[model samples]
Target: MITHTTQSVSKANIFLTCTDEKYYRDELIVEKNTVIRMISGEMKIILPDITYVIGAGDTIFFPRNDLAKVWKTGKDGRPYKSVAIYLTPEAMQQYAIKHHIKPIHPSPRTGIKCMAAHPLLDSLFNSLVPYFNLKNELPESLAEAKVDEAISILKLIDQEVFNTISNVEEPGKINLAEFMEKNFMFNMPMDKFGYLTGRSLTTFKRDFKKAFYTSPQKWLTQKRLALAHYQITEKKRRPVDVYLEVGFENLSHFSYAFKKQYGYAPSSI
Candidate 1:
């Protein structure tokens, strides 16, 4: 088994983790200097139209608030090792101002891109591993410099790409239909869904009804239950595994909902 570990480079507000696992993640605003350098293993992201598979040494820059349906897996020794720099919206704004850089804002909105092939990325991560291993607290100024250096390398490869992504935007900036479609599996509250899609509670509900022709709650439940039914009947998955996979918090609730939706127990499927 891979021993899952997370190390925070405090000065930079960056967190590093290496894991051998799988999960369903909610739609999130990328709130950090979001860089994932895949050191080993393989991962896949299922978006609306495409499935992107990333292997070792590939670097992808995920702009803030870009919803991702991420799935990761790794084997015994070669676990999924990744380096991430967390950046708040404030940090990016400040960095841009201090460096005298003007970031272009896309009119409709910008999507995430694969900023691959930064030559210094691997060495840069290697240098930071010692800091993570040591667990030492460092000055915030020094951490700021590290982030600058990261940007410098990224800038060298593609300054346009760097400037575009490094520029942060408000949460809930994504389209409601697209965001919900990409992230319907994770079972979060309706209010959270509203906030993520960048709408007031009333507006979220009103918009959701307009788009789906049903209440958010009813539509979400229908989506989850449909997925569960497909998993059980087509994939030969067990009720025990299918419950959490389809976003039910507990088995009993899942069973109740499953029966209510399908008129039969999940196991009987």
Candidate 2:
């Protein structure tokens, strides 16, 4: 079971220490304007468009009106432990608009591969752990000020670290052959798969081929066919079932792709 607390203030709402106890699957739902720090352990953020793996000593900020899910793997190789903080969209909107800051948007890809750390932003987030844990009587003005300070630090970091990447045109194709081999079992969207590793389709393909000398789509097809073959031969699952389960929308399409990649139709397996 997952345990957590939800608290609402005049201006913002927060969720602290939310996670599943068993450790196998843990998740936190974050609304807009939330700022999250990994107090300890490793956490992965899975979004519709991207995914990010946040380790200890890292902080992530979510601007207003975005939705996200955060997952943590287990400790002792058993289950994960985690804590989180949530802020309201209204509070963030008021502050950003009043201060003339462009609101933060959801990133298009996943992973920390592209983001560098800023010492100041890192320090500021580290300092907030105690307050987030305490959640005790804090002066509203002080609390608001602290949130604003965090936001300011994030803005500076964003300008320095994310602006250039965000503005650059994405590459045309991404190669996910190896990535698919490792993670294709998970039933996530293409964008989410791309995001979790912090690469847009174009960049993913470029880096993928550069690294593996193959294309992502082709790689994914090969992986699925291999998985299907394994399931048929070892797991005893039917070919049609495997095709649908591995994210194929159509059997004929799956067969065609399977044949193209493996030189044998899925049924032959």
Candidate 3:
């Protein structure tokens, strides 16, 4: 799994990605922005309630400050490829001024949404392919211009998408139970989940018990163990690989938990 931010090279938020396979990895997106172009391989982004399979040539626009769990896998051992351009506050402010687009507080209708393929978008992303191999970071001016070009395409792609990218994204105030069901695979601390769901930590735990009739930690253990067992036996994934993917911190603890749940060691299966 690659954990890199284009923030290192340019504050413009142009990041390059190359991956062979990624586990169920947790990530905190710094900006609620648009223009995720998948160039090659396969990518899956698991939001709290929705999931998307982003194959090569697919583009997705995500909400700002999204806490996501993702799975990225390659085709035939090749690296998965993509670019993410986040809408920096400065950029959004500038766009609103130049386009005479008002700052509207309209909330996005979906968790993470895909934009239909546009030839303009296709060409724009294609132009970025060579940057991945640059020995040094892209020049600051060039990176910002590329990001500008991407946003220009959004205005003509779809209105819904345009609004989603243009507006400042607020956290969704959603059903607690529904949120947990979709996000349980993430191995983050409880507070992170609570914050993402727009709840105080104490309120989150209380609501969690009311919905699950069980403690969050216990539920997470059982859920992860069950999935680990399924992967080990049915999918034939190695124990080493399954442990972290399902949220366990390490092998020894995962082994202990799996045995307690299934009455057998993971390797025994």
Task: Give the number of the best model, judged by TM-score.
Answer: 1
lDDT of 2 by residue, 14-45 (tens): 33453334432323322234556555556776
As for model 3, its CA RMSD to the true structure in angstroms is 4.4
Q: What would the per-residue lDDT of candidate 1 be over residues 136-237, giving only the tens digit for each residue?
A: 675678777777677767677766656655656656445888778777876667877788888888889988888889988778778888988988899999
Better model by lDDT: candidate 1 vs candidate 3:
3
- C-alpha lDDT of all candidate models, in order: 0.69, 0.54, 0.74
- What is the per-residue lDDT of model 3 for residues 107-147, given as tens digits with 9 covering 90 to 100? 64444777788899888877877776687877888877887
Best candidate according to lDDT: 3
- In order of lDDT, best first, we have 3, 1, 2
- TM-score of each prediction: 0.77, 0.45, 0.73
Local lDDT at 170 for model 3: 52
Least accurate stretch of 10 residues (summed lDDT) in model 3? 3-12
Candidate 2: worst 10 consecutive residues by lDDT?
161-170
